[model samples]
Target: MKHRTPRGFKRIPAWMFHSRLPVDAETRLITSYLLTSGSANHPTVSELSDALCMDAKTVRRNVYKLEELGLLKVIRRAK
Candidate 1:
């Protein structure tokens, strides 16, 4: 399946690659991954962990980071 890159992000800034904090880098990577996931997949934390080759903790942390930055919204569903 082909995915479309989101508008306004046609080019990722080079500075994202040189961020000083490790979390900043991971957050940017997660953002990139999420942008690539496109408008279809709403992956769970475990799934994101698997795709990104990171642990669940790392995935969750970066997800929250993205949320804080207003780049992504995390919806909680009641079980």
Candidate 2:
């Protein structure tokens, strides 16, 4: 039987896992979550922390690491 993916689920690219970039487990988890989160409703640091069951500081630190590695980008909206 063919397996069907759940509706509204984001599909991670295979290249992301096979890339030469060095991504730690936490970074990978964060990246995947971010990728799956819809553009209109991206979770905040606190939300991610709660979802991942990690400290907010830890989540922030990993987010920065992912940014440094070019896996994530921060865009500021004008107030």
**lDDT of candidate 2 over 1-79, digit per residue (tens):** 9744345545545565566777667776776667666563457899999877899998999888767765565321210
Q: What does the lDDT read for residue 13 in candidate 1?
A: 46
Model 2 regions more than 4 Å off: 1-11, 17-20, 39-42, 74-79
Q: What is the C-alpha RMSD of each candidate to the true structure, in Å?
A: 8.5, 5.6
Candidate 2 matches the true fold with a TM-score of: 0.61
Q: Which ten residues in a row have the lowest lDDT in candidate 1?
A: 70-79
* TM-scores, all models, native as reference: 0.59, 0.61
Clash list (residue pairs), candidate 1: none
The local lDDT score (0 to 100) that residue 74 gets in candidate 2 is 32
Backbone steric clashes in candidate 1, count: 0
Ten-residue region with minimum lDDT total, candidate 2: 70-79
